[model samples]
Target chain A: MSLDAATKPHEQLAEYLATDMEAVNRMIRARMASEHAPRIPEVTAHLVEAGGKRLRPMLTLAAARLCGYDGPYHVHLASTVEFIHTATLLHDDVVDESDQRRGRPTANLLWDNTSSVLVGDYLFARSFQLMVETGSLRVLDILANAAATIAEGEVLQLTAARNLETTEEIYLKVVRGKTAALFSAATEVGGVIAGADEAVVKALFDYGDALGISFQIVDDLLDYAGTEATGKDIGDDFREGKLTLPVIRAVAAADPSEREFWTRTFGKGRIAEGDLETALALFAKYDTLEATRRDAVLWADRAKAALDAVPEHDLRQMLADLADYVVARLR
Target chain B: MSLDAATKPHEQLAEYLATDMEAVNRMIRARMASEHAPRIPEVTAHLVEAGGKRLRPMLTLAAARLCGYDGPYHVHLASTVEFIHTATLLHDDVVDESDQRRGRPTANLLWDNTSSVLVGDYLFARSFQLMVETGSLRVLDILANAAATIAEGEVLQLTAARNLETTEEIYLKVVRGKTAALFSAATEVGGVIAGADEAVVKALFDYGDALGISFQIVDDLLDYAGTEATGKDIGDDFREGKLTLPVIRAVAAADPSEREFWTRTFGKGRIAEGDLETALALFAKYDTLEATRRDAVLWADRAKAALDAVPEHDLRQMLADLADYVVARLR
Candidate 1:
C-alpha cells in the first residue's frame, strides 16, 4: 500500500469514523462548556478547536467500532479520552512553561497559569463525569488507573530531568506514563465497553500500549533527527536538557570527556554555542539516535503484532496501518 | 454551652472518631505512595501531615457515623475527601502563587510548580481510585459532580476577581466552589456510602452545604474583622484585592470616590498603603462587614436546622456545634 498524504492512517480513520467523530466533537463542546464559568469554555475551545490530530480519541472510537460496538456511549468515551488529553496538555504547558503548542501560544502563555491550571482541572473533572456517564465500572477502573500512571510518569520524568543517572528503564516508564498509558486506556476502554472477549480486550490494550510507546519514541527521536516535515525544531529536547531515551543510552555508553560534555549541558543546564551540533556529534558517535529509531520500529511492529488477536476488519487493517504509520517517518 | 478549648466541636468529633480517622490516615498514606515517583509522598506528606485540622474528612466520617454506617469504606470515603482537598490545595497554591498554607511554606514554594501540579494530579487520580474501590456508583456520581462544581467555581472566581461588578450571588457561588462543594460532597458521600435513606442524605447534604457556606463566609469576614484567635491576618483579602462578600457589598454601595478607590485597588490591582484601612472604613460605612457576619450566622443556623431530618444522636449535636464553632469567631 502506497501511503500518500490523503491516505495517512489517522486521516483515513477520521474519514471512516467521520460521523462518530462529529458526534464526539459535539459531545466535547457540549461538556466543555460551563454554565457559570465562561473561561472554562474559552480555554477549552482554544485547545480543543486547535486542529490537533485528535488521534487519541480516534483510537477510542476505532477500537469500539472494530470491536463491533454499535452503542451510543462510545461517543462519551471518545470525548472523555480527548478531555483527558487536553487537560494533560494544559497542565504540561504550564509545567514546561512553553509558550507555543500546536503552532500557537499556549493557554498558560495566553491567559495565565492560573487559568491553565484551573481550567485543566475543570476538564479533568469533566472527563471524570463523562466516563461515569458510561456507567461501566470496569471502564472507570481502566481510566482511573491510566490517570494514575500518567501522573506518576510525569512526576518521574520531572524528577529524572537532567539527571545523568536516568536509566532507559526510567525513560520507558516515563514514556508509558506521558503517552502510552492514555493510549492503552483509550483502546482498552473501548473493548471493555463493547463487551469484547478478554483476549480481544487484552490485544487492544497491548496494541495501544505498543503504539503509544512507538509514538513517544518517534517524538523523542524527531527532536534530534526531525525535518521540517515533522514540524518539530531539531534538538528541542537537547535545548531543554531533557534526558530522553537517546541521551540516556548515549550517556550510559559515554567515556570521561563525553560524560563531562553531558554533565555540562544536561546536568548543570549550561549550553554554549554549537552545543546542538556537538550533541548531534555525540549521538552520531554513539549511534543512539539510530538505536532509538530501531526501538520505535520494534514497538511499532509489536503494536501491529498485537492486533492479530482482533477480528480482522477494515478498521483492524487501518489500526495496523496506523501502527506502521507511527514509525514510518524513520524510513 | 461555653465552648472550652479542649471541648471544641472538631476536637470532640476527632476524639469520637479517632479510630476511623486513624484508618483514613493509613489509607491516605498508603494511596499517596507512588511506586515509581517518590515525590508524590513527599509533597503529599508536606501538606497532609502539616497538622492542618482535617475538618473536611471529619465531615465525611461524622456523617457516616451519624447515619450509622459501620462499613469499612467510609474510611475510604473520608480519605478520598481528604485527597481531593489536598489535591485542590496543591493546585490552589500554584494558582494563587501562595507561599504560606496552614502557616507552613506551601509545596509549590518548597519544591517547584511542576511537582505541585503533577502531585496534585496524582492525588486527584488517587482519590478517583479510592472512590471506585467502594463500588458505589451513586457515591462516584456525587463526588464527580462536586469536582465539576468546584472547578467551575474556581474558574468563575478567577475571571470575576478584581471585577467590581461581582455580585453577592457570584460571591456565594465562588464560596460554594472553593469550600462548600467538597464539604457537602464529603458529607453527602458518607451518607450515600452508608446507604442512608434519601431524606437523611438530603439532610446531610443540606447541613454540609450550609455549614461550608457559613465557614467560608466567616473566613472571608475574618479577612476584615479578624483577630489573633482566628489566625487570619486582617485585610489579607483587601491586600490581595479579592472580591469577597463584604468587599462586594461595599463596592455595590460605594459612591464615586469609593468606587475609584476600589477601581484602583482591585480593578487595577494597584493596591497601596492605607488601602486596607480605607477598605475597612468603607465596609464600616456600608455596614457590609456586619451584614456579611449576619449572612454567616444565618447559614450556620440553617446548617443546624437542616440536621432536624437526621436521626438524633450525639454526633448530630456535635455537628450542630461544629457549625456554631465555625461562625463563633465573629462573637
Candidate 2:
C-alpha cells in the first residue's frame, strides 16, 4: 500500500493521469470559486483537495486517448466527469447524514445542511455548463443518463436505508446505479465523442462498467473484513443497517440463529455494541467475505476481457492495470 | 383584486393558459414519476399537486405559439421550464427551512431534508433529460443557462441571507437570476426553436424577462399587503429579514436613527416580535413599497411592448394579459 515503489500500479496511474488531471484539478478549483459565495470555495475545496484517487476522470482521459482523440476538449470532459462525481458525493453526504468523509468532517457537518444542498447544486450546475462547453451532444447524452442514474441510486439508498429485505439483485442494481454507471459513462462518452467506432466505444463502456463493478464490490468486501482501508469505519454499514453484497449473501445463507440475529440487528436497525463482532462472525461462517473477494476478481477479469476489443497502447495498458488495481485491495 | 368581472383580464389569462398548458401538465406529472425511486413520486406529488398557477409554463407555451410554432416540441419545452422551477422550489423550501408551502406542510418538514435534496435532484436530472429529448441545441443552451443563473441566484441568496447592506441592484440580480432567467429562457427558447427571427425571439425573451421581474416584485409587494389572496403570510419576508426590493430601497432612503434601527435589526440578525411593524412603518415612511409597485407596473408595460415584434395573435394577446396578471397584485 506504500507509495515508495516506482512500479506500483497506483503510481503508474498517477504518472499516467498526472499531467492532464492536474489541469482538471486546476479547472475544478477555479470554477468552484464564487465572488459572492465565499463558503462555496471553502466547502468545495475541502472535498476537492481531499485525497481521492481521481479514478473516474482518469478513466475518461484514458478512454479518449485509447480512441485516438487528439482534441483538447477531453480535458474539459475529464473535469466534467469529476464535477459530476464530486457533486454526487456532496449530496450523498447530506442524504446519508454522514459526518465523516475520508476521515474529515463532511460539508454538511462543518457548514449546515443548507450549504451542502446549495453547494452541491452549484457544482451540479457547473458540471452542466462544463459539459455544454464540450459541444458534444453525445457526451451530454451519456452524462445526463449518468446523472439520472446517480439520483435514482441516491433515492433508492434512502428508501432502503433501514430495510433488511433488500436483495442481492437489488443491491447490485443500486451499486451499478450509484457507482458503476457513472464510471462507465465517464469512459463511454470519451470514446463516443472521439469518433471511436461502435465496437471500441462499447468495449470501453463495458470495461468501465466491469471496472466500476469490481471497484464497488471490493469496497463492499472491505466493509466486512475489518481491514477496510477506505478511511470510513468498517462497522458503519452494519450500524446504519446497510446490507451490502457480503451482508446480502450472509443473510441468504444464514442458519436459524443467524436469521434471528439479522432480524434483530438489521431489520430492527438498532445494533448494540459487539453486534459488529457477531456480524463479522456470521460473515466468516458463511465465507461471504472470501466469496465477495472472488466476485471482485471475477469482475476484474471480465473488465480486462472487455479491453481485448481495443488496440493495445500505453493508456490502454494503464486501464488494464486499473482493473487489476480495483481488486488489489482484496489481497 | 377580487376574481370578478373587473378582474376579467386575469381570468381570461388563466383560462388561456389552462387550455394551452394541458399537454405540459400531463407530461410533467407523468415524467416526474419514477418506478425505482418512489420518493420522487411521493415528494414531487406533494408540491406538483399543490394548487398553484402554472404561469412559468404558460409563458413558455405562449411564446412558442405566438411565434407561429407548428411543432410538438414546445410541449416538452414548457414542461422542462416547469420541472426546473418545481425542482428549485423543493430545494429552496429546504434551504429556507420552512414549515409550510402553499398551506401544506413543506416536504422537508413532512419527509425530511434528505428527501427534499434527493427529490429535487431527481426532478433536475429529469428536467435535463426531458430537454435533451427536445433535440434542440438552442433550447438546451437556454435551459442550461437558466440552470446556472438559478444556482448562482441561490448561492447569492445564501450569502446575502441576514446581511442588510445588500443593495437594490444586488437584490435585482438575485431575483433576476432566481426568477427572471428561467422565465425569460422558457419563452426565448420557445421562439428560437420555432424558427422565429432573432428579433422576434429577443422580443419574447424580453417579454418573459419583464414579466418575471414584475411577478417577483409583486410577490415582494404581497409580503406586505396581501391577505388570503396570495395564500402565503403577508410579512414572512419582513420577519425573515430578507432585504427584498422594498427593504433595500427603504434602507437607502432612511434617516440616521432609522438607519441605525435597520442596521441593528437586519445586520445583527436580531429583531423583537413587533420589529416587523417597525420595518413596515419604515417601508411606508420611505414609500418603498409603493415605489416597488410602480417598478412592477413599468416592467409590465415593458413586457407588453416586447411582444409587439410578434404579429397579432390570440396567444400573443393572452401572453400580454398574463404579463398584466403577474402585476395585478399591485392593485
Best by lDDT: 1
Runs in model 1 lying further than 4 Å from the true structure: A98-104, B98-104
How much lDDT does candidate 2 score?
0.80
Residue pairs with backbone overlap in model 1: none
Q: Cα deviation of B203 in candidate 2 (Å)?
A: 1.1
- Docking verdict class for candidate 1: medium
DockQ of 2: 0.57
Q: Show model 2 residue runs off by greater than 4 Å.
A: A1-5, A98-104, A226-229, B1-14, B17-20, B98-104
Second chain alone, TM-score for each candidate: 0.96, 0.93
lDDT of 2 by residue, A232-300 (tens): 567777877777888888889988988888988988876788998998888888898888889889999
Chain A TM-score for model 2, please? Answer: 0.93
Question: What's the TM-score, to 2 decimals, of chain B in model 2?
Answer: 0.93
The Cα local distance difference test for each model comes to: 0.90, 0.80
- Candidate 1 chain A has its poorest 10 consecutive residues by lDDT at A97-106
